[model samples]
Target: MLPRPVVPAAATTGALLLLAACAPTVPVTAAPYATDPVCAAVVLATPDSLGDGLDRVATDAQATTAWGEPRDAVVLRCGVEPLGPTTERCESVTTPNGPTIDWVIVEDDGDWTFTTYGREPAVQLLVPGAVAESRSTSFVDALGPAVARTEQLRQCL
Candidate 1:
């Protein structure tokens, strides 16, 4: 048998330790703020409790957040350009008297896409079909109150 190249014991130990320390850390890309100040405050006031099954992913933006690590299932983007005078249906969500926020919801292939209406510099959330089934209200409800601090005055009627 050909003699195996002997790797030093010390070298093997160092390799193992290096591999252990090199675990991947996924960093979420932050969404642009559209240069709005209100969006910044909402991010600061965001609630820490997002409920079970959803994890707050590490993000680059103060106003952007993802619900999964490495891969995002639910993404929240604040300060998107607001839609003006659209025929799309709007639903008013009742909050704990913070600020009334209306949502323009679109569902396709089980995926739920939500954008804040009756507000300037809208906030958008993309909820995957699978995630929406398990955690429909929990994620949106928690973020609503926080984002409501922006104080949208327009009504969705």
Candidate 2:
């Protein structure tokens, strides 16, 4: 009979701790105004999960967050440059029993990028096609409160 090898409890715990600490960090570029104090408030107010099993992930940049797998993560970056009047499609997303936010939509390669229209230190969300098709406005709704931390200066008209 072969003897079973014993692993030390402390060593096993240390290995588990190391693995837990090694969660992948989502790479995101910090926005030009990422250091703005309002960005912190927005980040702090963001929900831990965006429904549909999409949970917040660690980001490499300030005022940035991601949910779900890196390849198809819903990324949000606070402190993006505020938008001015534009002819692009703008949608006013009103969360259920929550705040209303205006987002200017830009599409590229079947992906949608939504940026806040009226808020200074604006926030931007990159939604992959699959998630957009599956989740629709849930992501935006989940983020409404966080993005609304900054006052709205205008509305989609």
Candidate 3:
């Protein structure tokens, strides 16, 4: 057999680095109550995709997940502190075949953040403007089952 050419150490290192960079992982900060058992259920119940080609992506934090491209992903973080009465826009969402969930809506710079109203270990969703506009309630409805895993103590009146 002919002698094989050996790759240089630097070239091998560079190639490995390039491969590592190609693997996408969305950066997410774990919520304060991330370790709560309820959060585990929420994460487990989350859908693999949010429709419109938004597939689930790996996350760097516990009880956190993201869907869609990293640059414009829809992020979900479980185990946030529960919300008491709030003046923020709240809505009661009833999914077609899932449980009804209450969410407090907040908008910042065209991005929408929705948090479960009164669940002990609340779930938060950071939705990009474009995706929210296109999917509207569909995305939230898709997540209702997961969010519903937590016990809701209050709702929009």
Candidate 4:
């Protein structure tokens, strides 16, 4: 009968070190985005405004496009722009009149959903009828330019 000999600690350690040296290390790059004045103005928007702080505009637009709804009345601001194959950049503000601001860059599959809470009530406008009509128009007015700028940004990339 024969017994196997144990390897010495130094030899085992050297073999392990050699194996570790052969392993690969991958480098991850940063997400693609531009932080210029035009992009920032549109991307870093607040409630009652439209801009690019978020990256889900394209997702919203795709959902909107699929929904086939011209526009959502409940949404104080609606804007969309593309960002590669599986992502989109979006910024929206549902204010005191409407009541919350959401800036997001959703990724892949159009399956994300979450509810947000705010201090103010979720009314489309503080007042109703003609007064609200004026307000809604104002929202569109403020949001339009930002949305347009975002659209141009999508092309830039």
Candidate 2 TM-score, C-alpha based: 0.85
What number of clashing residue pairs does each candidate have, in the order they appear? 0, 0, 0, 18
**Runs off by more than 4 Å, candidate 2:** 1-17
7-94, model 4: which lDDT tens digit per residue? 9999999999998666432221211232233434543342332232211221131112111111222232222222233234434544
Against the hidden true structure, what lDDT does model 1 obtain?
0.70
Taking the tens digit of each residue's C-alpha lDDT, what string does model 2 give over 31-113?
A: 99999999999999999988866888888999999998877888999998999999999999888899999999998887899
Q: For every model shown, what is its TM-score relative to the native structure? A: 0.71, 0.85, 0.83, 0.22
Candidate 2 residue pairs that clash: none
Give the CA lDDT, 0 to 100, for residue 20 in model 2: 71
Ranking by TM-score: 2, 3, 1, 4
TM-score of 4: 0.22
Best by TM-score: 2
Off by over 4 Å in 4: 28-157
Model 3 Cα lDDT, one tens digit per residue, 9-75: 9999999999988879999899999999989889989999888679998889999999998878899
Which residue pairs come into collision in candidate 1?
none
Q: Which stretches of candidate 3 lie over 4 Å from their true place?
A: 1-22, 133-137
